[model samples]
Target: MNPNDHRAALADIQVTAQDVKFSTIVCFLAWTFAVYDFVLFANLLPVIAQDLGWTAAQTTGINTWVTIGTALVAFFVGPLVVDRMGRKSGIVIAVTGAALASGLTFVAGWMVGALGVLGLVLLILIRSLAGLGYAEQSINATYLNEMFSHVDRKNGGGASRGFIYSLVQSGWPVGSVIAAASIAILQPLGGWELCFIVGVFPAFIMMALGKKLKESPQFRARQLVTQWRSQGHTAEAEQLAREYHIGEETGVSPLKAAFSGESLRPTLTLSAAMLMNWLGILAFAFQGTLVLTSGKQVNFNDALTILIISNATGFLGYLFHGWLGDRIGRRNTIALGWFLAAFAFAGMLWAPNGSYGLVVALYSVGLFFLIGPYSALLFFNAESFPVETRATAGSFINALGQVGAILGGVLFTIHLSGLTQESAAELISSTWINAALIWGTVPILLSAALMLLARDVRPGRQS
Candidate 1:
């Protein structure tokens, strides 16, 4: 405990590259399946609707309800479970549940053409279950946070996590590619049933691989969750005590205790950050595909291709942004991202017809900024909240963000159709106009303002 001993201990402190790499890979894989399952539902909606006897309205309704379900359930219940059950159990159970739900989707698809209300009901239920699993984003964020150390937590917070999340986020594009390719390959052989049946394979792999996955070390350290310590593995518990400053006496409900009057600044800041984060998610999910859909004579393949490109580009930007956030500051990086996204959205509104090159460029730039903040905010939120409410705050913030997502879908539907424009060119213009209004100017400005008012919570900085 003397200065010499402390200095010596600091000199010997080391975290191997191998450890970081292995941890990152595991997290990436976990997130990849999580993203795949979440996005797969939307990616194959066209096939699902056709094979399941859904009208346009009905299909849209299904998506709306799923968002609503995610917003409602994930916001409150998801955090409670994650906080109470611990990140390891939350992820494992969520993955297993999603796998089972996907299996059911395959079964429902088998009854296609002659599908009944029963089949439709089952599919909807399964989709809702998958939405529940989507709540794993919070758990995954906690897992990644726990895997790294104090130094790693500060420098590698978003940098490492962004890369992992980028890979996981890539699941959307990959799932779309897989869905499109599978439908093309299997449509002739076994019809849409083949696509759904094939879909179950990935979930199966994810579930099995997840079996080997260990609980996050930090999760074991938290004072609120006791199961990790109850297993009698004191090495991890003791290590956590030394590293994270957590001990058995301190782990209580984070939400209940972390948000006292004294902690209002962090509470409000995280709430705003999470709110905007979910809004971005909504915009990406609905607007990304919609932009291409509004493209003249654009096919599903082309739409999916554009999405893949956007996601790929965004992934790279995430890494760049993570570095920026760690080096510069989370608030500055996030604000810069929002501003860039806003600018890109504005350009998209004014671009000429069939200007696919310019369109993609602007959209890509916007997405770059969007993901920089999105990727980094996980750590920002985690660091801002106390250990007791860490998971709870994430759950609440993310759950509330789902409301923004629901609005994004509804806004797109309303404005795009209600524009009173006949030509596809005009429709595209109007859609961008509406998107600019919703996602571009206003949201960015609001987020930037919020960031300005918020307190920074990066670790190592005393409040």
Candidate 2:
């Protein structure tokens, strides 16, 4: 590549400042509300079960089935929609799908009496749409990763990149707070069904905002490379390849590229780590109030308050780690956070007395590490693969977190038999400590360990 071709390739990839901020704002809003629906379901799970007259065993069964559907649906968004269509398209579809899921969730409540278990079937399918919401992170991460490439580290744009992304990923804690608080407020006004409606409007607005987003430069560059190569314009193709660091596996399909040669190791290790980490996230974060209530640390009413407070504090973790990841590296930041999170949770679970303040303190510290690392991990996953396979591989890893959720659900159910006799308020399990430790702390520790196996996610970092 001569200087002119190199300059041309760089010119093609350069984006305006407004485009950057616009993309970030849209991604943040899209992620925030999508996760709002996901967390809402968790917040309302026990209520949904009680309203539908499902016992503890039956409730976890429903959740597991929904997660199975979510895992299946996840493949469609990342591999098919994002990789095949475009990153911008994937964002719009994912946000819209999540909103549609929320509206249908309200309908599922009514159908239980009319359709009986079939209504639950409807609920399963509707909730499965969260697969789109879950996949949105990878798609947005890919888009933002490419968008931020032009910004130089020496000028502080690189650290700002991490901070910028950390702000977007902070949506998890924001969503959690919204979900828990909405239920607390709306449940008294009507029922848990009202909370389902809250996610709908904001999601649609984000979807509309997402539609206007520009296709990522990397996506456009990859397409140009393939077209030029096939048209026998080898000079242009190879030139862009040199400038943009185009991936070697360009000839193969996106999904296949994800599992082949250079892409395979990080795909395997990162996917495995996410699987283990999410096992803790699903069992503890999703059903956080129950973990507190079931373990006898706090009663049901107080548990909600604890969840809201503790999750709010978790916000600080995202900023701190995001800033930290840019200084050292994303992989190191992620592993270190999760490793410490495991101990924080263990201390919370086994404290001599389950005092409210102490429980809140320990749980807040635990979540700070547990969920915070994702601020780096999501971006790490994006940078780990080339633009061609970025969405597919990242989404594949994200989808497997559902598999972890399935594993988490299994652990939750296996221990629920003894705790099932009472309603959620009076819920107590002599096995709670054992179950929490096994499913929560144990898997989180393993998740941190798996991160050590993967390579760093710097520029063109995929192995």
Top candidate on lDDT is 2
Runs in model 2 lying further than 4 Å from the true structure: 1-13, 153-157, 248-250, 352-354, 422-427, 459-463
lDDT of 1 at 383: 58
Candidate 2 residues 1-463, lDDT tens each? 3658656755766667688889888888888888888888877777787777787767777888889898888877887888878888888888888888898888877787789878878889999998888888887788888878744421345655776788998988988898888888998898888888887897658756866787777777777787678877788788877767786544677778889877899999999999999889986798786677667557666888888887887888999888888888889999999999999999888885457777888889999999988889999998788777888898899999989998888877887765554545434544666778998899999999999999886632322
What's each prediction's TM-score? Answer: 0.77, 0.92
Off by over 4 Å in 1: 1-21, 46-59, 76-78, 109-121, 150-193, 223-243, 247-253, 261-264, 295-297, 416-436, 439-441, 459-463
Model 1, 214-326: lDDT tens digits are: 55545544541243357665564466466665545444455655566434676676667556655555555444554545432345556666666666676677677666666
Error of 2 at 106 (Å): 0.7
* Whole-model alpha-carbon lDDT for candidate 2: 0.81
Q: How far is each candidate from the true structure, as Cα RMSD in Å?
A: 6.1, 3.1
C-alpha lDDT (0 to 100) for residue 38 of candidate 1: 66
lDDT of each: 0.59, 0.81
